[model samples]
Target chain A: MDNLQTEIRQLIIDALDLEDMTAEDIDPAAPLFGDGLGLDSIDALELGVALRKRYQVRLDGDDPSVKRHFHSVNTLVELVRQHSERTA
Target chain B: MDALASGRPRLHRMTHEKPDGVTTRNTTLIESRGLTPPIAPGRMDSFSLPLAAWAAWPTHAPGCAAPTDSPPPPGAVDIAFVDPMLRRRLGPVARMALNVAHRCLGERTGVPMVFASRHGELARTLAMLHDLAAGEEVSPAAFSLSVHNAAAGVFSIARHDTAPATAIAAGDETLGMALVEARARLSEAHPQLLLVCADAPAPELYQDDITTTESAHALALLFDLHQSRRLHVARHASSGTPSNSMMSLPLADLLAGHRPDAAWSGTHARWEWTLDDA
Candidate 1:
């Protein structure tokens, strides 16, 4: 995994209180919600807040363009990269 | 469930020897006048029900508990027996509350619960406030679980028990109010309900306003409406002296059978609990 993915994975673990998990434990391709890692809506909001604080990127669950990015950790990594590049 | 078998205090002594404050009472007399009005604004409120089971975590005697400010953080209660996924959202008070509630229920399910805490997650709330003050967004997970009823919410979710769950914070009378709520909810259809009371110490910011040493503890009592022996709860006009004691401590003593009767004082009234001989 890239450094961004590792960092985002750590943020997810820290924010969600997934104390027993490590970056490697989370499959980047796995769906973060139902049918995969099994996080709920609360987890999504929590992850959003964590990402906002860490990367200064706001991924609104209500926004159509950003909702797709919440599908997987890889998508979140992509969102953060796109966000950082846009600001740069 | 045998409470003594679970390493709780012996009930044998409770019925045999009277503790300093608790006296053996005739239930018939108290039942006849439960609703008798007091001379003041808040009247007498009393409920008597048989206790099916009782449990408290951190089995340390009340006064012995050190403040949560030391180490292990707010969420670091690794009791080892709890499930990881279910435990993620629980902090110290919720963690201990859920443990004792589970102990009271064991394999039993669907009993509605009324959880009480004097200061529910004050530390967590204070931290969130600090974050917001620094122009940082508070944690969503922390904010969601920081409510007064967070423990009850987590308990029901973890058990997959959709039964009604209520959270209560009534200042000094929190534990007593919860017992009353459980009594009101108990009926023929639901013969039993659980009362779980847990408290962490007040954050230092509010400590100066408090005169008594705050005891950090959690306890759960299972009350059955059908049983003969009763746990008599009574509210009286305040003893006039303010009580800074944590209500759950005396309650733990009452449940452990060390003290058959315990009372806590509030500005308007004083709440009392007594155990009838089984």
Candidate 2:
């Protein structure tokens, strides 16, 4: 996994209080909602705020595109990378 | 016992060793003059909640009789039994309540629950408020868990309890009101229920204006109306007010064969609780 993907994995665990799991435990390609990691609406919103605070990765929860980026850790990394490139 | 049989009110002084080690004395006046007859048929304003089993965290009050069944589990509850998903989200205070709740209702499904906390999730709420004031977006997870009834909601989800659950916060008299609510709901439709009272002190900013428990603790009681020991609660409008009902201790102290007078007065009515021997 890329450093950014690993960082995103750790962010998800810390922001969601998944204390029992480590960053390595989360599969980058696994779905984060209903099945794979099993997060919910609240966790999604919290992650959005955490990313904005940490990496300045702005995300509008109501935007249809935001839903797609939250599908997996890989998608979140892509979203963060795109944002940083735009800012750079 | 003889003092109450006669029409005499007794004034007893109790010193509470706050978790911070500061001692505060509260003088509880047990006034039973000419009030014994009302209990013969049982007073309308008062109610009897028969308890089946009771458990509390950190059973170390000033006058608590040693627990008979076994010692209470430490501050952190046994999480081996809790779902990993739910266990992670439970704050320390929530864990305190859940630990005792699980103890009283172990493996017993569908039991109705009453969760009472005087300052429910105050710490979380205060943090969110600070974030908002700083022009920062608060964590949605914190907002969701800051509701007064969040403890009950989490417990129901963790246990998959389909039965009724009510969360209560009644200022200083939170425990009394919760017991009253439990009594009204206990009937043939629901013969028994669970009552869990938990509270931690308000954040330091509000602590000066708000009287709070020095430490975080929770108590759980399994109530069955038919039990031989009857809990008699009498409501009286007070002329002079009393201190906050050390919600964590007074009742638990009474049950531990320690004190007999755990009473508190709300605005209109004060509740006097007397646990009678079988």
Candidate 3:
């Protein structure tokens, strides 16, 4: 879980062109959008694309649970882990 | 020629001056580089530099020639004033426009803005098209930002300013048309208008169709209606040669205190521009 959290944190920074940020700057429990990282709808879309490309996991844009999956690094780590386990 | 003969807004001229008196308001070239300095007149000599250097070129080398890399990237754009989250999504063209616009606004808010570009968001549009061709899902963010008015819209959102903003693309006459739009927006109530003209070079596939070498560039001009120096624009016959958008070059020269009338041909018309002291 720790490794996955760090990897997802780095992915967010790289995919979003967060030039001033590093993986350590992202708190695992903090929200990825709104008051935490201050991300918006565009970042969500870009991050979804990046995640799909990296994980080879299909993400349905209309899925309601996608919002919960993107809430924080901890949540994103679980989501990726589930997808990886399901595929494995 | 037939288009002109068919009464397509042909040979029209507009003059703007303060009705109350001969007011001399400040006209500042807020932030610009490359084509702003007086280069050799009558040629697109400034396009030879990399897009990043357009506004940074020294005035001492007026006509110094340099080889430009074909299909140069949209070089460094310093738009640190914009919020990082929002700024990260902006493409090169938007970054260029916002960089200049923010510099010109400089603490001023609630001003009307006119953004002019010959190929607004062309690069973004091309990228989206490629995604579609590859059977990839076009990112919703990219699609939304690919519009012509995306820059102006983003600028308004970033500033939280609700003042009127307009985007224009009129082929080679984009800059002239944008100035016309700015003049129309100016009034006694809104004495000043911010005009930004920017363009990124067309994508590599379309480079062969380009007439003159174009490099990415953006310029901001602050126009005060009460200014004593008035600009006169009139349409005339074509100069009998193909030309690209180079209005910003002469505009920069004029801003640099060169008191000379200039003329340039666009795709469909010839425009004669002169600045005179009222």
lDDT of candidates 1 onward, in order: 0.73, 0.71, 0.67
B-chain TM-score of model 3: 0.73
Selected candidate, larger DockQ, 2 vs 3: 2
Which segments of candidate 3 are over 4 A away from where they belong? Answer: A59-64, B1-75
Q: In lDDT terms, how accurate is model 3? A: 0.67
Worst 10 residues of 3 chain B by lDDT: B45-54
Please provide, for model 1 over B1-278, each residue's C-alpha lDDT reduced to its tens digit, 9 standing for 90 to 100: 76545644331211323222222332112111212222345556555767888888666564335644231344545444455666777778788788788888888888888888888888899999999999988887788889988888877777778888888777676776677567556666788788898877788899776655676678888877656567888877554776766777776777776765887776556778887755
Cα displacement (Å) at residue B36, model 2: 26
Model 3: per-residue Cα lDDT over B1-278, one tens digit each: 66345544322223335333222222211111221222123322110000111131113221121223222233456777777777777887788788878877777788788889888878788888999999987876788888888898889888888878888776666787676566556667877778888876778788776675565667777766556556655554344574544556555554455547766675545666566565
Taking the tens digit of each residue's C-alpha lDDT, what string does model 2 give over B158-193?
777887888877666678767767765676567788
Where is the poorest 10-residue window by lDDT in model 1 chain B?
A: B26-35
Docking class of 3: medium
Per-residue alpha-carbon lDDT of model 2 for A19-68, expressed as tens digits? 77999999999999989998988888889889999999887767999889
DockQ for each candidate? 0.76, 0.73, 0.58
The best candidate in terms of DockQ:
1
- The TM-scores, one per candidate, come to 0.81, 0.78, 0.77
Clashing pairs in 3: B33-B54, B33-B55, B34-B54, B34-B55
Q: Which pairs of residues collide in candidate 1?
A: none
Model 1, position B7, has a per-residue lDDT of: 46
Best by lDDT: 1
- TM-scores of chain A across the candidates, in order, are 0.93, 0.96, 0.95
Instruction: Report residue B27 deviation for candidate 3 (angstroms).
Output: 24
Per-residue lDDT, model 2, residue B143, is: 85
